[model samples]
Each structure stands twice: as structure tokens, then as C-alpha cells.
Target: MRAIQITEFGGPEVLTLADLPEPVAGPGQVLVDVTRAGVNYADTHQAENTYLAASKLPMVPGGEIAGTAGGRRVVGLTADGGGYAEKALALEGALYDIPDGVDDMTALGLIVQGATAWVMLRKSVHLEPGETVVVHAAAGGVGTLAVQLAKAFGAGRVIATASSPEKREFALSLGADVAVDPATPELRKALIEANGGRRVDVVLEMTGGTVTDQSLAALAPFGRLAFYGMASREQPSPISAPSLLRHSTAVVGMWLPHVLTLPGDIMRRAMTELFDLAAAGTLKVVNGGEYALTDARSAHEALRSRKTIGKLVLDPSR
Candidate 1:
């Protein structure tokens, strides 16, 4: 099997394509012939050995794949089993049967970013129908999905924040009631203005850097903020302890890999709804260009640069 292997942690250059032995599925695992693999910022953190959990050396970075196992079409999350290859090992229990009407890209989008967006709002915060939702990084992978899912989940108003006007427009087309630049001075005030002078009820905080402080300040009374990642790779501003007490607000953090461990049917249920939305042509995935499996280095560079919008996936057959 061909794969991009990392024997040492470093930059994207460390990801070298090599002919590696095919991974055999062990006890309850299934060997997946990979079709597409989602590229995420977590891959960059794994390459640098800076992720929350230490990445094992000589590892494959992609955590989610849409492919086949035993002739049954499926999508699976491999956790740490090396998905950046032509073949991946998927836990049999983790496999989701891809329906005939759903395409691989939609399935690919649903597993990682799609599921993340679904879980955060549907399970984590229990987003209400009329709540004002704020989504940061609203044009990126999970951001785009989060924007769409927030609307589907009945958010009354969704304010999206992005770095560029084009990206902000993209978010608006995906159901955001308003999209604004987060780089503007007094970002919290800008977001509040974009929300029609209302404070936020829920926020999806991805790039923590300065957005963390700004988003927190914009939270409504009894609001909740789901801090997921620090894509900026910069330490976020610390929250003042009194801020939460002042407004009866809450701050919650989520890491997809960690949340996947909760023993329950939440993932399956949300995933089913996501797929149904996709099949019905409701979910809009921006699908940042697909690259060849061997071009993993460039893919990582593109993601790190934040130039690509929506989800990026590698085509092993490309």
C-alpha cells in the first residue's frame, strides 16, 4: 500500500510518500481500501507533535475516511490507525453504511467536520430554535458545516465570522444571517452589531487566539461557548473568572477524538440526520480542492495557510 509516513514530527515536508506494507485489520477491525481522506488542522498539530495528545511517531495523520470494507460501502473514523494511505484499518463497529443516494464527498464531509458540527450543537449545547448562534471560522471546514447545521437545528439568527469578505459571503450563502470580519477592531462589538444588536446565545470558537476573548464578551446572558480548536496556533486570551458569573454564561471545550469515546448512540443519530440532510441537498459543503494522495505535503501547507475554505480531502486514486 502507498502511504505518507512520518517517522519524525516536524513540518509538512516530513510527510513522505513511501510504499508501506498493507495494514491488516486485527480483532474486530476491518481493512478499508481508501477512497477519500479529510484533511484537518489536527494533521498539522500531529505533524508538529503539538496536539493535545502526543502523536505516535511513524504515524498517518488523517483520522476520518470514506471507503469500503468487505465490499460493503462505508465511512469510518480510524482514530490513530493511519488514514493517509491507499488502505486504512477501520473498526468494524465504527463503520457507517453509506446509502446509495449519498456521494462519497458528502459522506466524507459528514464523518469528521460534519459530525463535529452536529454533535456540538445537537448534543453538547442543545441549541434551541430561537437562540442566536455565533460561529467563528465560519467559512472553514467545520465552520461551514456548523453554519448550515445551526440553521437546520433551528437557530434563530446565525452570525458568522471570517477573515475575508469572500469567505464571509460564503458563510451567508450557507444560511448565516450575517457574516462579518473578525479582524476588525472591537470585534465583540462588531459581532454584536452583526447580530442585530443582540448578544450571542451560542458560539463555535475554533481559532482561539484573540477570538476567544472577543466571542466571550459577546455572549448573551446564560449563553454557552463551545471552544473546539486553536487553528491560529496561538494561545487564546484567558477568560476572566468573573465573566462567566457576571452573565450566567458557560464555556465548553471539545476535541473530536475525545468526544468520540463517549459510549453512546449520539454520534449515530446525529450522523444519520446529517446524511439525510446531505442526501436531500440541504447541506452545503465547500469542498476545498482535492489533492493527490502523494501530494500530502502541499495539502498540509494549504490547510495551515488557511487559504482553503470548507473541507479538504485527499483522493488516494488521484
Candidate 2:
């Protein structure tokens, strides 16, 4: 099997394609003939060694994959890495059968980003039908899914923030009621004005740094802000403790990997619900682009450059 391996942490250039032995499944795991591997910011972060968790060097950097396991079409998350290869080993429970209409690339996108979006919207925030919600990075992997899921949950209004007009328009097409450029000086005010001067009831904060602070201003009283990813790749702003108490808004940090450990039942339920939504056509996975397995470095560059929208995947057959 050929896999992209990072011998050292640095940049996309550090990811090198090399021949590797095929991974064998353990007792509770199944060996997958990987068809498509989901490329996420976490993969880039791991390559750069800047992720929240320390990445093991000489590792293959992909979390989710869609392929065949034990003769069954499935999508799964791999904790032991090696997803950038032609074969990967995924836990039995981590693998779910791909629905009839979902393609390999789309199923790969849904496994990680879709699960993150569903868990955050459905469990973390418990978004209400008539409440307004704000989604940051509205055109990225999880952001695109989050926007659609918020609407499916019957959010009264969904305000999405992106860096460019094209991304904003993309989010709008995905069910965002209003899309604003977060780079604008009056972004918060614009979001409020667009949503009939009502503060958002829930905020999906992906970009940290100054954008996170701006999102704080757009939160309604008693609202929940689920801080999921730090796309800004900068140190988070120092939040004022007093302001949080005064506003009565809750700030929650979500780490999807942690869910795998605590409450196995919840993880199973979430994946089942997400797969059901995908099967029903209520949830759509937007595949930004697909790259050959050897082009892993290029995939990382595309994500880091913010030149791609939706989810990117690496095709093993290529």
C-alpha cells in the first residue's frame, strides 16, 4: 500500500508518499480497502504539529474514510491513522454502511464533518426550532453541514460568516438565511440587522481569535456558543470572565474525538441519526474536490490557503 507519511512536523511539503505494508484489522476492527479519505483541517494541523493534541510523527494524517470493510460498503473514523493509504483498519462500530445514494467521497465527508455538525447542533447546543443561529466559516467542511443542519432543525434564521462573497453565496445556497463577510468591520451589526435585530440564540464558532470575540457580541442572552475549531490558526482572544457572567451566555468547547471515549451510546446514536439524515436527502455532503493519494500535500495546501470550500477527499485508487 502507498501512503502519505509525515516523518516530521512542518508544512505540506513534509508529507511524502511512500510504500507501506497493508494494515491488518484487530479483533474488534475491520480492514477497509480505502476508496476515499476525508481531508480535514485537522490533517493539516497534524502535518504542522499545531493541533490541540500532539500528533505522532511518521504518521498518516487522515481521520475519516469511506470504503469496504468485511465486504460491506462503509464509512468510518480511524483513531490509529493510516487513512491516506489504499488500506486502513477501522473499528467495527466506527464503520457504518454507506447509503444507496451516497458516493464514497460524500460518505467520507459525512463521517467526520457531518458527525461534528450533527452532534453540535443536535446535542451540544440543542438548537430550537424558532431560534436564530450563527455559523462561522460557513463554507468550509463542517460549516457547510452545520448551516444545512441548522435549517433542517427549523432554525428561525441562520446567519453564516465567510471571508469572501463566493463563500457567502455558497452558504446561502446551502440554506443560510443570511451570509455576511466576517472580515467586515461592522460584521456583528450586519448580522444583527439581517436577522431582524435579534441576537443569535446559538453560535457555531469555528474561527477563533478576533472573530470569536465578535461572535460573542452577537449572542442572545442565555445563548450557547459551541467553539469547535480554530480555523484562524491563532491564539484565541482572552475572554473577559466578567462579561460571560454578566451576559449569562455559555461558552462550550467541543472536541469530537473525546466523544469516542465517554458515552459510547451517544456516539452510536449520533452516527445513526447522521446516516439517517444523509439517506433521507435531508443532509447533503458537498465534496469540494478529490485528489490522488500521492497529492496529499497539495490537498493540505488547498485547505490551508482557504482556496477550497466544502469537504476535500483523497482517492486511493488514483
Candidate 3:
């Protein structure tokens, strides 16, 4: 099997294509002949060894995969890290049968990015109907889905923040009521103004540092900010309980891996709904770019550049 293995922790340059022996499935795990794999922001973090969980050395770089197992089409997360290869291993419980009408990439979208958006809106923030929602990085994979999902969840308004006009326009096309530039001189003001001169009720925030601070400032009373990722790789100013109490606002941290561990069908339910939406064409799954298995490095470079929108995948068959 051909795989992208990283022996050292560093940048995208560390990901190298290599020929390795095929992996055999152990008990409770199924071997998947991978056709496509999902690339996520966390994959980049894993590559740099700065992810929430530490990654072992000399490992493949992807966790989400769309493949066939036991002659059945499936999409799932690899138990450890073998998704960046021609074949990988996944727990039987982790894999989901792809529904009819849902393509590999669409099913792949729900595994991580789509599920993250669903949990962030439904569980983390507990979004209510008619509440204003703000989605940052609105042109990226999770952002694109969050914008549409917010609207589907009956949000009164959706404000999208991206880096460029084109990206913002793309966000608007995905049901964002308004689009603003995250680089505005007064981001807080811009966010509020985008929300019709009122603070937002819920926010899906990822970019860290100033964006976090400004997003917090733009929150309305009793607003909830779901802080998920720190794409900027910069730390935000310390948040104090007193400040939160004074504003009656909450900052809830959400990680998909943690949610997947809870004793419930939360992840399964979310993935099923996301897949159904995509299959029904109610949700648009943006196909950012499909890179050949060997061009995994190029995919990482594009993601790090923050200029690409929607889900990026690697085609193992390529």
C-alpha cells in the first residue's frame, strides 16, 4: 500500500509518500480498501505535533476515510491513523454505511467537519430558533457547513466572516444572511452591524487571538460562544469568570473526539442527519479540491494557506 508517512514532526514538508505493507485488521476492526480520505485542519495540527492529542511517530496522517469494507461502501474514522493510504483499519462500530445517493466525498464530509458543525451548533451552543448566529471562517470546510446548518436550525440571522470578498460571497450563497471581513479594523463593530446593529446570540468561533476577543465582545447578553479551533495559532487574552458573569455570556469549548466518547448516539445521529441532508441536496457539500494520494503535501499547503474553501479530500485510487 502507498501511504503518506511522517517520521518527524514539522510542517507539510514532513508528509512523504512511501510504499508500505498492507495493514491487517485486528479484532473488532475492519480493514478498508480506502478510495478517498478527508483532510482536516486537525490533520495539519497532527502533522506539527500540536494537536489536542499527541500523534505517534512514523504514522500515516489521516483519520477520516471513505472506502469499501467487506464489499460494502462505508465512511468512518480510522482507529489510530491509517487513512492516508490505499488501505486502512477502522473499528466496526466506527464505520457507517453510505446511504444511497450520497457520494464518497459527501459521506466523507460528515465524518469530521460536518459532525463538528452539527455538534457545535446543536450541543455546544444549544442554538435556539430566531437567535442570531455568527460563523467565522465562513468559507472553509466547517464554516461552509455551519453557515447553512445555522439557517436550517432556524437561526434568525447568520453572519459569516471570511478573509476576502469572494469567500464572503461564497458564504452568502450557502445561506449566510450577511458576510463580513474578519480583518475589519473594528471586527466587533462589523460583526454587530452585520447582525443588524445588535450583538450575536451564538457564534461558531475557531480563529484564535484577536478574533476570539472580538467575537466575545460582539456577543449579546446570554449569548454563547462555542470555541472550537485556533486556526491563527495565537492565544487569546485570558477570559475571567467575572467578565462572563457580568455579561451573562458563556464560552463553551467543544472537541469532536471528546463528544464521540460520550455514552450516547450523539455522533451517530449527527452523521446520519448530515448524510441525509447531503444526499437529499438540502445541504451543499463543497468539494474544495481532490488531491492525488501522492500530492498530499499540496493539500496541506493549500489548507495552511487559508485560501481554499470547503472540504479537501485525497483520492487514494489516484
Best by TM-score: 3
The digit string of per-residue lDDT tens for model 1 on 1-318 reads 888899998989899988889887788778889998878888899999998988887787788888887788899888465888999988666689998988777787788888889889987778999999999889888999999999888999999989898998988888999988888889989988888888889999888778888888899999999988898888877777787899999999887766556788667887888888988888867778789998999999998888789888888886
- Global lDDT of each candidate: 0.86, 0.85, 0.91
Better model by lDDT, 2 or 3? Answer: 3
lDDT of model number 1:
0.86
- Give the poorly placed runs of model 1, Cα more than 4 Å off: none
Task: Compute the lDDT for candidate 3.
Answer: 0.91
Local error of candidate 2 at residue 122 (angstroms): 1.4
Candidate 2 lDDT by residue in tens digits, 161-267: 88899999999999999888888887668777878988778999888887888788878888889998888886667778887887788888899887777665667
Q: Which stretches of candidate 3 lie over 4 Å from their true place?
A: none
Please give, for residues 132-190, the per-residue lDDT of candidate 3 as tens digits.
99999999999999998998889999999999999999999999988999988899999
| Alpha-carbon shift of residue 251 in model 3 (angstroms) | 0.7
Top candidate when judged by lDDT against the true structure: 3
